[model samples]
Target: MPDATQDAAARILAAVRAIPRGQVAGYGEVARRAGLPGRARLAARVLSQNTDRTLPWHRVLRADGRIAFPEGSAGYREQCQRLRAEGVAVVDGRVRRELMAGAHGDLDAMVWGPPPR
Candidate 1:
């Protein structure tokens, strides 16, 4: 039987994995979706302790759609690079609001890979 920590980590990781490619969700939203509402810090903590390189950690951002890493940090640069590789526009270290997972017309962008221009 898994301990509570393991269970929580599993739920958190699963929620993170559910975020589709080229899309991003806030830490709070991920926590909410993981059945652990109001535990955004737990989500961040679990992610910080993760060892799997395959996890899409870059797809998670702050509530305001900003990168959580400090500016000029390696993590911040890596996150910006990863997001841009997925066709997500990262301006001044923040994902464009219209491109966030729950934003308006996000379904169209997610399904069709953003409109040209």
Candidate 2:
């Protein structure tokens, strides 16, 4: 099972890496995209230990679009700043979905392109 676990981690990392700049996805959504449904917490755990700064860990949030950090904490402030730098509006501790809703709320479309016009 070690290999399976390692692969799962890899998949989760890949999913997180796939999040486009200026856009964000929920932890649950990231897990689902990694083919690990119902494992949002696992995704969060993996992220907490993430050392690769390029992974864009700030792009992952609760399903409600809120940053997971305490409202006034350093992490909260940093995440808000980083997200805003990417042009993702975080208003009232939650991302305004309309601003970041370009594509991929649907996993299939995220992997493949939208259906023919």
Candidate 3:
């Protein structure tokens, strides 16, 4: 019964869940991996709507490594808690990239496919 947008969002969430523990992906990255390039806002919207559970939603963050949830908000606290639980270092409500796992794809492979362009 899901609409096209909802189905797309679900696909994005599934991609997000594929992110291994201790790693994180930016909103834009999630969108791109979900086959919806330049749709970071849509990714965020989907995540927001499904925050009630069933997805590893906390693994998605802003491009600058900051938790997208606003500071002092319930979601922010939950995000920090979740990241910390996953061994992802969080300071000042932001993730420290050096302390977390790197992204999955390599430069050439990411842009040109695994076999190269």
Candidate 4:
């Protein structure tokens, strides 16, 4: 991969690491936190190739607050289990909006420092 791509992936990983145990962020939100607006797909792609299992990969989700894994699949079950274990309500495969109320809808600030809001 190009240096830019590698750098972006590193940034995304850093942002993923910053997500608190009980909080989750959409892929788009993570991309924004990585300083790459409108690059949600890039974040997902980076996650697919992620080797650092220590990163909170499961805390990243679709923009609609849905887990990307197919429902009923092992990955899906794992994602749901991991999220619920973090106290993030996973209802019908979608995380509760109440838990995401403090979300960062804009990309003007560094989201990884303070909790997104």
Candidate 5:
């Protein structure tokens, strides 16, 4: 049987794997989906130690839709490139919230910000 750590990692990995291509999820969101709310740091840790080259780790981002890597870093550039290849609009290292995976709120409001008076 897997230990608690292993189980948590498994669940987190599964949650990450479930994020569809051309979409993205926040680290906190991934943790919540994996039944480990408030474990966003754990999610990032697991991804950092990931050995599976096939895992779509780049699909996970900060809650505010920003890439976690420092700007101008190789990781940052690669992440941006990967997301753009999937048709996701990335601007200044920030992804549009409307393009985030599982987003179900008001599309117009999210895409265009608050409506004009």
Candidate 6:
């Protein structure tokens, strides 16, 4: 059985997976949605540690629309490719915030899950 922290991380991953294609949420947003405010780094760490191949891990990004993975890395390339395939516009290796804004309707609902406690 997973420890409490592991279980929490799993739950966070589940919430992240719920974000639809063509849409992305910020790391801080994911943390807040996972019932762990101020734990954005923890959320990122959980995603990095994830071994689940099916998780749409590419759909999460920094708040500035920049890919979270390091530049020139395989993960960075994969993230760009995934976003492109989903019709999200990425320019100069960065996603345009305007494009993301248009793609993600109901912005608050898309990023934030429940009301923060």
Across 19-77, the per-residue lDDT of candidate 1 in tens digits comes to 88888988887888788989999999999999999999999999889999999999999
Error of 2 at 39 (Å): 0.5
lDDT values for all models = 0.87, 0.84, 0.78, 0.82, 0.87, 0.78
**lDDT tens per residue, model 4, 1-117:** 999988999999998888878877888888888899899899999999998878889988887788999999998999999999988899999997645523544333334456645
> Model 6, 1-117: lDDT tens per residue?
469898779878986887778877777777776788788898899999899999988878887888977899998999999889999888767787754432455445545657645
Better of 4 and 5 by lDDT: 5
For each candidate, what TM-score against the reference? 0.85, 0.85, 0.79, 0.84, 0.85, 0.80
Query: Which of 1 and 2 is the better model by lDDT?
Result: 1
Candidate 2 segments exceeding 4 Å error: 99-104, 107-112, 115-117
Scored by Cα lDDT, where does model 2 land?
0.84
Which tens-of-lDDT digit does each residue in 1-117 have in candidate 2? 499888988999999888888878889888988999999999999998888877799999888788999999999999999999998888988997643333335644654666666
Model 4 stretches astray by more than 4 angstroms: 101-117
Q: Which candidate do you rate higher for lDDT, 1 or 3?
A: 1
- Model 2, TM vs. native: 0.85
Alpha-carbon lDDT of model 4 = 0.82
Give lDDT: candidate 3, residue 9.
84
Cα lDDT tens digits, model 5, 1-117, are 459999999999998898878878999888988999999999999999999999999999998899999999999999999999988899999999877744754322344577566
Q: Could you give me the TM-score of model 4 versus the true structure? A: 0.84
lDDT of 3 by residue, 42-89 (tens): 999888878567688888898788998779999999989998899888
